[model samples]
Target: MEKGIESIFKPYLEPKEVYKGGKNIPASTKKIYKLSSNENPLGQSPKATEALIKAAQNIALYPDQTDIRLREALVLDFDHKLAADQFITGNSGSEIIDMILRAFINEGDEVIFSNPCFLPYSVFSRWYGAKQIDVRLKDFDYSLDVEGILNAITERTKIIFLTGPNNPTGTYIPKAVLEDFLARIPKNILVVYDEVYRQFADAEDYVTALPYVMQGYNIVGLNSFSKTYGLAGQRIGYCYTTAKIANYIRQIHKPFLLPITSIEAAIGALNDKEFIANTVKTVQDGKIFLADAFASLGIKYWPTQANFFIIDPPLPEMEFTDFLMAQGVMVRPVSQFGAPGKVRISIGDQEANEALVQALVKIKTR
Candidate 1:
């Protein structure tokens, strides 16, 4: 007798909440300010637009299988610190994460991350039958509990995920603290750092994990052109790791995985330093503006090094999000992100920022 499909999947099945993005406006609504997704408020880069257009002219040709040009561009952009072979470009940082899991995770292996870290870590881990370990962050500032994570490690632990300027909470690991944690971790376990929002971080102590990768630790630093380069739609990202690990990850990744246009857009976006500079400045300025408004309104919010911040809403998380939607504004209700009763709001353009502030004022009075 053949096994049923349900029976085949029963052992791996578990209740999981899919990643939820911000809500879209009703079709009938005349206007809406979308501050839900942490998208580039400045819009796509002009240079990227030009490059993608040029690359599209040759749509019949397949993209470079080796991604040599894109890797060369990355080397130049990083001031030649890392070789081309050390970087592995992929469709997106999320895809690279999946590749890492596929390359390393065996059945029943353990993967550890903070409770509210990136959603996909656990999502992919489950697909591979890896045991998921959630380490609760420190309560006061929502920072990663280094001690807790260290204690959670066991003989079965295969990988540990860390996010600088972590999502939903906007907290970051300081350089000194991270170094201390890294020093003590067993050399066998891989440490993957998701630094997708690194460019927006201005905290004096915050640092990227690339140095550790160069230092030959089993570290992988993942970056995406989606956020800082304004190429989310393009879906281009890369990871920097040791050559041996890069080769292993490449073995798992399919060739010609990215579109020609995405590769070109990322290359072009690198040339547009002005656009990246402007984006960082805009988010920084908007962060200050929004934080000030929150303080004046007596609304509680946490400090963030990323483009988005979390707030303790006046009402229940879902209720507050619904109210904002009714007011023609969209924000992310982050209950599923382990941030129950809070909402994460992304920094938007000036007009949208003003609209969100106005909406908050209404929430206060209502």
Candidate 2:
């Protein structure tokens, strides 16, 4: 115990609350319906699972650190029209976020994002000793206030992080609105657009920043195989930008690139068109069903463009969550996201969705 050593780490000492997901109740023998974390209800892509199994036999060998095969598959199969060099892979979307901050942000620089958007944005910004400017969500709908974000920018602002189909709320910025916002922003400031839930969106007006990236805008598009391909456990995600920016991120990647099995699984997941299609369909259908159930129960819920939605139950968020847990269902209480008294429920399979609806109904009667 060196007494002086504590002083060195004092600047990094700050209270941080761990992000909570759906709680798992082990004591219950009943079939549990985990609608907590927004995971693929249909499970991982069959092709991805098979690929991982095959790749396991060769785990002793090192994977291509550059992730050439996975990047190529993304371009060819996803019709991105970008060269493989324009993409960079990460252990997870969270890692890419961290790398972006590490590579571009400096101490005392300002980072702007919505207050309730993503927990990691604040967590990482603080870790880097950057100033965080959080713009509050507009009204009860929890929509992003584009004007607030635009006005919050200062000369020292290094990055602006926007999550499409935003976490916790499942709300998104319209394509036209985002285009207008970007046009007004100075090109010197980098914009990080996290489109992790883009595949689940069915709105005609929804769009990706890939087109903006193609036009030489100072933007980076972050995506993950976690949701669409059910590869959360695999921890694979990627980012797309100009080749130059991609190169900077890759440099920081160094010895931290994704493992061999994750690369193979991502490649297989990208190639499996059927699995992707079915996953989208399931999420869309489940959303509709859940919306109907909410209406029937007279519960207030926000319209979601992603795989989950926030609802204000008759009970407090934590109490409601506990009730669901006791009934063998799990959901997320988002007080940490700055919207207290609301819970976010991920769309599960039909049976799981029904279980949640039935639980709510029983709670109402009691």
State the lDDT of candidate 1 residue by residue for 1-366, as single tens digits: 987777757466567656655555568635788788788999889999999999999989998787889999999999999998899988888888988999999889999999677788888888788999999788778988998999999999999999998987999999999999999999899999999999999999999988898899999999999888889888789999999899888877778888999988999999999999999999999999999999999999999999998999988988898898888889988877887788999998889999999999999997
> What residue runs in model 1 are displaced by over 4 Å at the alpha carbon?
13-15, 24-29
Candidate 1 clash figure, as a count: 0
The sequence of per-residue lDDT tens digits that candidate 2 reaches over residues 1-366 is 666865777474366665454455466667988888898999999999999999999888887757788889989965867888888888889888989999988889999988667788888888888998998888677777888988899899999998888988888888888999989998789999999999998888898878988988889999988898999889999999988888877887766277889988998898889999999999999999999999989999999999998898779888898899888898888888777788889999899999998999999899
> How close is every model to the real structure, measured as TM-score?
0.97, 0.96
Q: How does candidate 1 score on lDDT?
A: 0.89
RMSD of 1: 1.4
Cα lDDT, model 1, residue 348:
87
Q: Give the TM-score comparing model 2 with the true structure, all chains together.
A: 0.96
Native-referenced Cα lDDT, model 2: 0.87
lDDT of each: 0.89, 0.87
